[model samples]
Target: MEQVTTVGIDLAKRVFALHGADGAGRAVLRRTLRRDQVMEAVAALPPCVIGMEAGSGAHEWARRFRTLGHTPKLMAAKFVAPYRRNGKNDGNDAEAICEAVSRPGMRFVPIKSLEQQALLSLHRVRQGFIAERTGTINRLRGLLTEFGVVLPLRSVIVRRDASKAAEALPGLARRAIDDLLAHLRVLDERIAAYDRELEAQARGCEPAQRLMKIRGVGTLSALAIVATVGDARDFKSGRQFAAWLGLTPRQHSSGGKSRLGHITKRGDAYLRCLLVQGARSVLHTATRHADRMSRWVQGVETRRGYHRALVAIASKNARIAWALLSRNEELRIE
Candidate 1:
């Protein structure tokens, strides 16, 4: 077989499929290996460019492959999907990855370090706890309404009123509500603990600390951005970074005409959400400040409307964040 110069791997829980191509892009080797044999197989091959989807265990594999003197590039599954020629199976997917990685214009996901992966795990767990608490709160509110007691939407009010209202309910109903309330309490405590942990992480991390200097950025947002965006330099500009976060408008153009719609909502939804929320906070207080950023935000709100202003601010913040991260500089609000 011709020397395999590029490889694409379809990673699965137990089985993995690999497609190898020579420098001329001719298929050279195709193989499937069990989980146990994957490492040895890759380690035995001559160092070359390897490509895989940025999902699940791909980062760790990329790190491992890099140690073996191979250039491992990870692409979003959506980007690889276009290259798929046949039915969606392991073999075709691997081939698509192989082709996608070789494209000069193809975008690649930055390989995250162990520290980044660890921090993201914390963020994920904290977010999960928060979601669970929200569900519990909603359930409690719904139950109370059935008993002719309507609770307020605010979590604090719900917690206070629900407990008092639960006391007046019948035996079984009260027990169920009480159990849910207990779970809510546990979730609240755990979420608080995670918040403190994230805050400490933000305080300790220089990049996150710089990010926190922005008007709307806080502990969680700062830390989340720092963790998710491994290397800001991977992006050529702040505008590119904002687009990556899906803060930019979606474009649909033809015949030399340009049409723009709502944000494409691509990339990490969680990160985009945090940015939007942060932007909202900035918009709320823009009136209180006379800074250049505040003025721009107010002008956008005046001309475009409220929600668009929020998105604009979020996009600007994302760009600012990229500049700070890439340049290793502090934010100087003017």
Candidate 2:
């Protein structure tokens, strides 16, 4: 068999499809292997470049392949889609991955370390808990409204006033609200626990600690940024980093004219949301400060409206974060 110069793997829980190509890009091997047999099959081949689509287990597989003395590259699944010429299947997907990996300009997803993945998992779980908590609170408020009992929007107020409000409702409604309020309290405690864990984790991480020094960034935002963007060097500039975070506007240029629309919103929604939330907090008091950043934000709010100004600030913050990480420096406040 011709020396397998490159290999693409279609990963699955039970089965995996692999396509191998020679130096001249000619197919040399196409085979399917059971999950347990995958490493054995790969070990049989001489060291070569291995490509896989970015997914749940992609990073772990990439790390495994690297340990086996092969160069592993994980490409975004969308980037490999254009290479598929036939109906989608494991074989076709593997072949497409093989072709995409050979492209000189194909972008690859960074392989995240276990620690980064762990932090991200925490953030994801915390987000889910927060969402559930919001739903619970909304349900409580809706139920109370049915009985002509309206509480303040703040969660603290809601919690404090819920019991009194429930007393004025029907016995059944009162009991239901009582149960929901209890659940809400539990979720609040869970969310608080997660926040404390994240804060402690951020305090121990040097990059996160540095990120916390930036205005509008707190423990959660700093931890999210550090966990999401492991190596800022992967991005060419702060602008590119911001673009990756989907904070930049989408462009549609044709002929000599250029059309820019809303933010692309292409990357991690959680990270973008955190940055935007931070920006909103900053915008609330930007007019009270005379710093250059605040003044610029104020000017933007005047010209582009408050919402657009918030996005711009978020993008700027993302860029600043990239610079800090890339240069191994802290955020320099002016």
Candidate 3:
């Protein structure tokens, strides 16, 4: 088959599209394989560069391909989208991935190890629980409002006051709200358990421990950052790391002039949210500390509005995390 030099895979749950090309970029193979046949098919090909869009199961497949002496690369789906010549289909997507992987300047996502994936899984599950809990809280509040009972915004207060208010309501309403309150309690316990697990995991990770030394970074943020960005060295600089986190500004330029807009908000929304929330916590207490970081944060907050300051601090912390992880050094307060 002309000794395939490169292959691109369009991955799916049950079916996969494969495109193979030779040294001069001539198509040598185009085939589709079932999930079970993917590894068998790849093992039959000569060692070559394999490319796939960065998506679910891509990292595991990349690891498997590496074991078979093939070089695996994962590109952002958006980057490969530009290479598509025709309507979207598994075959055309495979071809586009093939073309995108061959580009000299193409950026690739780092393949995550099993441990990293496991940590991310924990974060994802915890986030889901949190969202569900919030929905439950809102529903409870709405139900209470319909019954002419107003509750405080704080969850603790709402839970307390709602339980008390339910006593005065009719039997059916009381029963329904009592059930929701019980569910909320269950969610609270689940969320707390997840937090404890993450804390234990962070304590065992030296890098995460080092990250926790930084101001505005707690166990969750530390573990999340370490797990999300496996190796900070993959990024050239902290700014690049922050950019990957979507903490940098979006750009619009024309005729040699540059315009900057709001943040790109491109990657890892959960991680970004954690960082921003941490930054907010820091800003709220910045006045209590006279450190350089606090002073800078206060200055930014005073000059620009609080929202902009919060984002700026979040980006700065992202950069700081990159520096600490890349250099294997502790954060020093100056």
Candidate 4:
């Protein structure tokens, strides 16, 4: 129970590996503790910086460790990857975590609060329901074609066609179509319910409120930002934040020369997707407006086509979002 300076924990389901280094950089403690004994074991030691990978149960353990007077840091797995030397095992990974956290230039993940996690959970559930509904619609469309019925392009039209087809269907096909429709209805209801829940949650958050001032951002984008970026202060700049969300063009450099390429697309896929989809809505509905971003997008569309413009606008939107986030104010889009 000496004064430890840095502690690296490799967490697992039933067992945990702890590697502790003393103030003098000596390997003073190495032990395997049961899941139940983890807190008790750490609590006995003096307060120190505890580094753990952003894995399952890490946040709960982080809260627990912080309560026990230790500073907890969540390290991204990718950041720790370079520290791995030779074979990768629990002990090696624990050592790598130690090495990674000890470095001065390592970036850390901000721990999300319960409310933020709740918002994210709602979005995930809604996404699943939407995917399910889409599958049901496609299946319905495919099945109707077998009976010489061609569905129209629109989803609503397909839905209506499916309903009418079900009514005129034979015994087995009717039952199958009925079951699919029922599931689709249930999914739609679930998605709507979650949207309401998220909207309510977003209303109370200041960052989300500020985000809604932008043209493209709505309840979903606002809530997604609150859920995804837990603390805006953790980011250095709006550009950095935007890049972190995969909203910036990537670069390729060699021999002191640099060339920019497509977006890196290396961070949270969900938030990036939400931002892009929100931007698409803007393109579809508000591109006629005389705003700078909208005008830029229109120009790109005239030259490169629609999707390319969409991505460019989405990246710009993310940058604007980061600016709004860092300043903690409503957007002043012009």
lDDT by residue (tens digit), candidate 4, 174-231: 8988888888888888888987888888778888888888767888888888777877
The TM-score between candidate 1 and the true structure equals 0.98
Q: In model 2, what lDDT does residue 232 have? A: 86
TM-score winner between candidates 1 and 2? 1
Return the TM-score for each candidate structure: 0.98, 0.94, 0.97, 0.91
**Model 3 per-residue lDDT tens digits across residues 131-207:** 99999999999999999998877888888888999999999999999999999999999999999999899989999
Which numbered prediction scores highest in TM-score against the true structure?
1
On the 0 to 100 scale, the lDDT of residue 268 in model 2 is 86
lDDT of 1 by residue, 1-334 (tens): 8899999999999999999999999999899999999989999889899999999999999999999999999999999999999999999999999999999999889899999999999989999998999999999988889989987889999988887888888999999998998999899899989888887888789999999998878888888888889899999999989998888889999999999999989998998899889999999998898988889999999999999998998888899999999999998866
For model 4, name the residue pairs that clash: none
CA error at residue 273 for candidate 1, angstroms? 0.8
Q: Between candidates 1 and 4, which one is better according to lDDT? A: 1
Candidate 4 residue spans exceeding 4 A from truth: 145-153, 167-169, 285-287, 299-305
Q: Stretches of candidate 3 above 4 Å error?
A: none
Rate residue 8 of model 1 by lDDT.
96
Whole-model lDDT per candidate: 0.92, 0.91, 0.94, 0.83
Q: Rank the candidate models, highest TM-score first.
A: 1, 3, 2, 4
Question: In model 2, what is the error at residue 237, expressed in angstroms?
Answer: 1.5
Give the Å shift of residue 16 in candidate 3: 0.5
Give the candidate number with the greatest lDDT: 3
